[model samples]
Target chain A: MKIETLFIDRAIRPCEEIDYIIQSTSLEPEYVENSKVVYDHVNLSDDPITKGKQTLYITENHGAVIKKCPGTSHYTCCDYTILHTGTFCTMDCSYCILQAYFHPPLLQYFVGQHKIDAALDEIFKENKTFRVGTGEFTDSLIWDKISNQPAKLVRKFADQARARSRSSNNNFSILELKTKTVNIDSLKDIDHNRKTVVAWSLNTPKVIKSEERGTASLSARLKAAKECERWGYRVAFHFDPIVIYQGCEEDYKEVIKSIFEGVRVDKNVDSSSDGVIKQSLGILPESIVWISIGTFRFMPQLKQIIENRFPKSTIAYGEFITGLDNKMRYFKPLRIKIYQKIVSFIRQYAPDVLIYFCMEDEEVWQKTIGFFPKKEGQLGAMLDRSVMERCKAC
Target chain B: MLNLQTTISNSALLKKRVKQVCLDAIDLSDESFKISSDNLFFSGNKSSSDNSLSNLTNLSNLALSIRLTGLINPIVLREIDDKYIVVSGFKRVSAMRSIGMRETPASILSHLDFDKDKTYDFRFYEVQSALIAISDNAFSRQLNVMEQARGVRLLKRFCSSYDIAQNSPAIFNVNMGESLINMLDDIANMPLSLHELIESDKLSMSSALKFKQYGYDKSLIESFATLFSKIKCSLSKQKEIITNIHEIAAREEISASDLIESKEISQILDSQSDNCSSNVNDENQKANLIRSILFNRRYPNLFKAKERFSNNLKMLNLNSGMKSDIKLDPPADFEGRDYTITLKFSTVEELAKKANILSALTKNPLFGDITD
Candidate 1:
């Protein structure tokens, strides 16, 4: 398990033989000598098309696949499907638990296409109506560089005509590849109907630069999301782990404002079955186009785990209290204020787009939205159920 | 014994008599019943022995009662010695009695005598009362999800066919709501021993609810309930057990149910009857159990010990600023010295409290054995 080093800059250095040209992180050691040392080659593979072992560090989580849906947690907004890709983020956000969520904390992509295809086939065959996403463990589209990205997933989904038809409704969507990066080149020409939501994990620019290292600028990611929307692809944006810092109001306000400016909300939301208000204006007819907003939340115990594992995390230090589920609760007033500002701003522009919160409690939900969902899974499930019902009637 | 069972259906007649007695004007009498007022007012007892002479005083702080002032409240009658026992008062009659009269006119009917053979034998009534005593006040006060579910199920079954004005669904709905609320408390109040049943696969919510159903067998259920509660509280306190929802459920099964249910196998299956109403309250109760444990970390003893230590620390006149510098000497009985050094308190108050409590334990025999 001896570690090796190679400086992988554009020019070959005779003195240094490094495996990777370590990109944007404060993680580089002067003399990297551990088995877990990350090889940071900008180009790991000689042939771009032929998939090499992704520089993305991946470990097979042979752990039980049937996990207690984290979506059941009130704070959790997004329904997780499967983590097709593993820990492979170029960004080194201080608060990102993926630093500790993965051991050896390297950017490795697992090329287990065969396993994934079989898994998806089984998932599609068994479930008539399921809302799943691959962005659980890894950024869904971040691995587009190493693998074919969601396009392969899109192709597989397009092939599932029988499965789609048998679903009794068109509520079936394959991959909601959420990302903070502006890499939509791979997604530009996919069949628009092949349920792939190219999601963006947007944060305030202050957070992005200070915390998220090697990630795209906020404008670039939004522009890319806008492009995907224009190309007839339904898009989603996530303000997850939205850091509640001073001036977060202005920061989040700008993000909401920019989103409406780039992505035409009216046209895209006009056709949505959910009748969600468009936070922006003028887009194609789509179903339930929206944004999921949430302040940073995690288990109280996860704080220690993060500190022990990823010691340099700065994002874990905002004031937190124990929530109802007894996980660390962000100050309610602070969270509510942020949510109110964000929702108001969103309502001002993309008033018709569905705006929801993830992993938030009933109290928070009721405060943010006018009412709380009837049942726990009802909110997320209702959107897909209504969409499916409408498509079936048609 | 004048039989009143035939008249049980005539709730209206019972109500009228209750109203007449309650409304009859009389002056307040002193210390009429031998039983304690606390027992009579709050002790959810249904029957009392005739000759036992409980000096139970009726509640006399009467202004206008809400029920009587608004409308007639129904009164339940128990037959006693050819006389009717008003389980609760029609407000008007109770008001007259409080106004000071001895034997203000009563609606006489026979008290409930489940065992007619022992009629007029006050011993039988006392024995029956003891048999019917639903819960032991000495045991742990709060019930966990499983325990509360069993208690509610038992009460529901016992009261379902009772001659209450409401039907089963109506009663079930009310009780189910209560159970749902208590279920959250159960999670909040679950002992660490039971947490193993929760955190591990040993106990499932379905099974835990079953345990709650069988809690009617108070002697058996109470013992296990106390044991599991302690286990749950202890696990959370010790920080030894997993607090995850599935894990807590599983662990609870292992420590609480698996071992106990096998011994009481018949009761376990019997309690898991499908006849129970699957209403919103019951469903939410069960859900809250899972949800609470999953989201909330259940280190049961931590807070209690921390509270105790904080109380002890408060005795010292030490300022808040001087808190962190205080050092604690470990007790002689304490097992690992490494624990003394490495133990990190969640807050400065916790550190200060622990330090003060430990330092004050110098006279204790276990003080020498303290770790680190």
Candidate 2:
């Protein structure tokens, strides 16, 4: 995210990291005592949500630097760990929960390498399994220019014994940097050690143009994923917040076709040629670790914000009713039909992809993919096994 | 920085002898006495436009009061060169004018709060007079939302919105948030028909602001105001209808005004009208019909799914309301796997019997079709 103005907390000690961000964005620093100053500053604007994206607040995270994923109740959680590095993103999608997630949404970049390293030390020191990612609350690569945390995280995970009183390879942790942007230049030369999986959120080209504002194109994101794989970093793809419209099923079918064509398949798969899947799979290295699909769902309060901010957007007008988790989700049959099509499309191309649903429940899993995560193992345990097997993590 | 009330009271203006003046000398068109908008009457909603800028409202009662005794409270006024302006008692003057009593006992303030000649303190006195006008009605009765909004519009000129929000209840008879100051301002600046919708509780603050952001033509707002005034729905219902209409219009690439004023919708609305020969007397039923139309237009398949689910639910006769003591509930919105069965029994034997009955229901294929 190229911030137009940088707001620094006055209590924050000046560091080279903060200086680098200010210099990179070419925005003069305005220090404030606390958040009220930033709140009042944005509250004065005609559009606070849009203005917040342009202004970046460089502040310290006084709370836990690493938190568990805030998975809603009554939904299957993937037992993911959240690297609470930041709070909001610059990309403007109509279906973004962050718009209602944050009260008066602001682009907050918590800057302190020591604190982040300290948080990671706990995970690295503990002899436990973790499937951690930074894309839970914000886009991971939106700040590759201003911050090299993703690259630094790659280095930290590679050197597994950096921070530990008890060193054991049994403690497995993979850092996933998921983004809608193609800001992977700094990550090119790093020795990721298969410890980092660079993932891109995939959507149709039509959605990318109309709804995903200021985001990389679908082709660009796929190209970046290929480059990340070329740089020896395992990659993943998420078709999260898949908006449903008239032609969305066919559009998503094309996207699935592009992903399987753009990325190489598993090495052990028979070089089968079903006219559509007849890509060169023999010489290329396998890159995809997993693919997650979650149809669009949001909190009810986001409806008004979307209506006001994205007046032209019709995504919120879907056949939605309150779910058990109290979120506005597409009707069950509607979600099941779409999920069935998407899962079938993915299975046709790469049967070994280890496809998973992001937040759907057991019944949906049974109807869509014919297997429930609970019946196999817990969803988290399943993901933990997949990540560990693919990345060779403990 | 003069205290306006103290200035009016201590000044010799009220102490001077009250006199009757020609009503023609007063400029009734000057809206200095009204915190309410003058032209807030939407075209088709004349039946319920009780506050249609008519200072002559409830004239018979005021005239009866005047006829019984006399002008017990002399109407407060201020002179403007050759003419006068009713500062506080607009209805009284209009009543007297209607009753053919060309003049009444009046307290003409030579030291005017609302001065005809603009002076250095002209804007300050206008603010004072606007507050006085709002306080007059607000103290007697609850000022409706639009009047309160118009009061905000009037007082916003002299103070910060923070001050208005902090001191709104005493002046406008309604509590307001500092954030809603913009909506209040919109109420003042919006067209008269939209104002009428708000005053009559047809449109809501949130919905009005949505239309304001749409920047659509005034006719669309007018059409919704007209429809809502006729239907007289709740604030939340108004929001839902407007939001659905906009979404459908946007998706179909049709003008929202044309969609609202379409022949089908008009026929549905006219179905419940007094003049129409149709027997549809309930506006709420008409509201449901409109909602169903929009629902079907938006998602034909989902509507069919809801219908199928409803039909399947009807097949299960184990509902507690009809002879049975069991309550079966699908998961909220039918989006999850678990279905709940509640058995209400006062005795253990009854519980066992209900349990056995519930067990018997397990074999019913229609019980499973609700999930399907």
Candidate 3:
């Protein structure tokens, strides 16, 4: 959030989107002919990762506008597609893989909106349903104040959904704006037509305070999700990178209870002729489209980064083993235990809500959720089906 | 010109005072000295009492040098109540004794008027004498850890009774900081074998200090010091191994002695000892093997994971082909969820062969285990 310096590529200086972003911030942009200067400056600092959070760069993304998520080989992937708009994020999480993935760790925003629109249009013409998100490399809504990209993307998805509704063939797409921020002001007035799923990454209060820096609180995020739900927008929740610590289960149970309290759910009741009534116990079962749960996992190289950045962190001091994917993870039994507890808590509160495991294998699914996706793309299809059943445009 | 005149006048004045002092002492004649080597006492100097110093490797060379050029510098001694205490020239006297010479030239400074006053403490005289001996040896070459330890040990005694500022010039001359003094005091009380290991540079001073700080039992310290000298390792590895064992013992609520006597550690030490006796050529490799075993014992979960990964790699059976060309790249320490399979080929035939191997490998269940 505290971007100390803004470096604009000479070519992107004339970009209208770049001008809009510059006009909104108090940062005076320093025009650079090449991005290598910014990279060199960041890498030369004493703490490159911390310094990187303070530096911003505006440049063009020459690569594909939409790309497949590079999921690992052994893990089951949901076939999620990413709308590549930038690299690196402003929020500083101790266990974030971006700390080691990017060398200079520069916060780069791509100024290629035309390329993105064309890519989205091509996807809209395709016969298959696409589940696209823009929060992989960066937060989806953190840059809302400057560029208003989320608002534009929501409108674009809404238009595509409306077009599909009129066509004879079935073609649909969902744009999930996943974020840890509560920047919902720009999203309030947009007519999304339920094509945009506003999702918040949820965590316990302890983790948010200790590890997640510069992010909204748990209550604030849920409040924003409640606001979006009231606007006729489909809402989703992601309890990802769930850190396992002492007394974490009770904390997570309370969070689950709060989620149901904040949002509305469908209920059914039956009454006999004697005026007796029996009500079904379900919370947010119909309104909350889906929830994904993924435990804390990291690349081997991230161990050193976490140690250097957060020396007092005990998150890495767990019983871990190298899985087939060659990443350090909690011991199989430990991960299964944590997941089972969380899944049970969720089922107790919202039994009928769509619950899926993000990047988890079939065995884990079988053990925790009592079922697994039949095939590779089965999870994606299930998510698309959930969207169709929940959203308005479908 | 005024500076030059002052220098000449001061030199003359210093000569006149030296002559007067010598006259008052009344022992200017060389015959007054007993030149017999047996008459000289080695007990006065603590460093000379070392048995290792008596058998110095360079004694013969010094003797040969003296035979060719004679002793240019006379051995210095102090007359304490008709007894000559050696203040300097321990090595010279040692070389003379090695050549079986009974008599040698020496200069003796008897108790003078300077020591008559209460301001001139006899303890100060003893400290200054030891300092002179240490400085003489230090100027010729670098004193080894043992000699330095002896010197620092002697100075530490004076440090407690006198102000540091008053005695700092003598202490600091040998680089004796408080920490170094503490280390030397600890080392002086250590067993002779450990002292020899430290003196020979096999064990570092910092590691020795850490061992003391960890409160290792005397027996455990001695056993480890002996084991370390037999096997070779870098200083950091040595420190890490010691510290790791200490920490593991603490975590397990066992004494360090009991931990070192554990079956796993004992087996490793015995096997390495056997390997060492068989004359293993790669010392570092042996050391690494020992360290790996220690680390595995300390972290069992990681050990099991590494074992499983190694077994899984072997299950791939990349060697089934007559010419193996495939490589599996797992993430470092299995800390990430990615694996890469690379096939190497130099010719079209090799490429075809690799493709066939890959097709066969894809059918195996282990392939799924590696890449879902």
Residues A355-394 of candidate 2: C-alpha lDDT, one tens digit per residue:
8988888889899989887743388887777777778632
After superposition on all C-alphas, the RMSD of every candidate to the true structure, in Å, is 28.0, 6.2, 13.5
Error of 3 at B226 (Å): 14
- Candidate that beats the other on DockQ, 1 or 2, i.e. the better one: 2
Deviating ranges (above 4 Å) for candidate 3:
A263-283, B1-372
RMSD of 3: 13.5
- Report the lDDT tens digits of candidate 3 across residue range B247-293: 55654557767766677555545564446564444446556766787
lDDT of 1 by residue, B66-89 (tens): 324532334333443434443333
Greater lDDT among 2 and 3 belongs to 2
Error of 1 at A264 (Å): 15
Model 1 residue runs over 4 Å out of place are A1-68, A71-78, A161-163, A166-170, A263-288, A300-314, A385-394, B1-372
| DockQ of each candidate, alpha-carbon based | 0.01, 0.49, 0.11
Candidate 1: count the clashes: 122
TM-score of 2: 0.85
Chain A fold similarity by TM-score, each prediction:
0.73, 0.91, 0.93
DockQ value for model 2: 0.49
**Best by the DockQ measure:** 2
Q: Please name the candidate that would achieve the greatest TM-score relative to the true structure.
A: 2
